[model samples]
Target: MDGYRGFLGLLVSALLVGFLSVLFTLIWVLHYREGLGWDGSALEFNWHPVLVVTGLVFIQGIAIIVYRLPWTWKCSKLLMKCIHAGLNAVAAILAVISLVAVFDFHNARSIPNMYSLHSWIGLTVVILYILQLLLGFFAFLVPLAPLSLRAFLMPLHIYSGLLIFGIVIASALTGVTEKLFFALTKPAYSTFPPEGVFTNTLGLLILVFGALIFWIVTRPQWKRPKEPNSVLLQPNGGTPEGVEGSMAINFGKADSESNNEAAARKRNLPLDEAGQRSTL
Candidate 1:
């Protein structure tokens, strides 16, 4: 779309890298290591990397940028907020499951847990991610927070989302490196064995994917434009009716109550002009 230059190409590249990262993870586990299982074998351990890469890394990246997609601008803001919260909830579930897989595998083999920097940072990221999800859901999506408070938290929300994403990528890189060191001693990772090369490539793809996501999200020109007459601004929608009233009450201070109601009833509002003001 004409909304932002370079966004389309960058988004396509990010998707390609994200899919490759997941596929390469699967190949590494199935072809090079034991296939997935849940009996507390090394197979069970395979689920950790796959779930983390797929759900935490790839899906979370998508969730972070969903609002920036120009095509989805026509949808209700409340709908987009729900989609965002749902995706993050899914990512949180997968992260917790992956942690369970790791702890279960460790306990079965009598291997110590929470002993590595990766584990420590990973746990912290997951906890913070859940907290962010809950707070954002309550603040913006639920309309409990005033417009001023939502506006105040918006910057922090964006910053924390990106920060959590970067930390997850770093933890994944360390996890894969740790795996290589422990699993490839037979051929010695320095020998450049096939698995070593393959896993290294996977790590690189993940890193590139993370970098692309950061670049796409941080670009000011790529931000989703504000929609003044959105469902979040209307009073007749089903679930969003409450959200609309909250917006009218909190953000409509520049005009009198009657004027706010008059403006809200006008369905002929132009997008270009409406895009100037931000409600959420």
Candidate 2:
């Protein structure tokens, strides 16, 4: 279908670049720096980069585009929302732990916290991310908020999510550069040392990954079709049987119905059946 054109290719490319960025991050910490650890040392600080890239950069990116998956269109929007929120929650947890590692490392060494420009931006982004998560859960996931509120907040929620993801990439880039400058004294960063070159490449990979995610989520045609009460989703989401039976009837007539008839039926249906007729 025209809606799905280039979706698979773009999705695959995003996945490949995302994983590669994660792998390069591991290599930087393990091979180039002092490997991972939990103690309040530079080793513990290594977890900061690893977790940020894995959680904030990679997993959060996946969450942003989860709604765009074509296969999941047959599933309930509620279930998809849960999956999306779950991914964001995990990313948030990792980001918090990464912050703890930084604070611990600094405290142990008597270094000041939130001193650098990168630290200021990173902390602000993390706080904004938590706020976004909480507001989204209440407005969209729970039934407490009215439709008008959800509609009003939807654009803000989307824009803030992408903005946070962009800031995360910026934070990662600046954080790495600051680390190189501090760590590379004998072979200064300006000398284009091996560590500087490698980290610069890592920064480029992160930029590419962020760009792909933004492109995937922003495209209008790639948005998932809305079929909230469809029978196809009931098997996985436990939708009410009555709702399933009614949706089944509509799917049964989909093949025989003319385009106008289908559109009329969709409008008249209780669940707002906006998915493709051929899919039904």
TM-scores of the candidates are 0.82, 0.81
Q: Count backbone overlaps in model 1.
A: 0
* Whole-model Cα lDDT of every candidate shown, in order: 0.88, 0.88
Across residues 1-280, which tens digit of lDDT does each residue of candidate 1 receive?
4545589889999999999999999999999996999999899999999999998999999999999899898888889999999999999999999999999999999999998998898899999999999999999999797665676798999889999999999999999999999999879999999999999999999999999999888888888876754344322332343346566556557468768677776754666357766542
Winner by TM-score: 1
Q: Report the C-alpha lDDT of model 2 over 1-280, residue by residue, as the tens digit.
A: 3546588888898999899889999999999997999889899999999999999999999999999898887877789999999999999999999999999999999999988999999999999999999999998888467555565788999999999999999999999889998999888889999988999999998999999999989888887764654343333333333366566667657765777787887678855454455458
Clash numbers, per candidate: 0, 0
lDDT of 1: 0.88
Error of 2 at 50 (Å): 0.4
Worst 10 residues of 2 by lDDT: 232-241
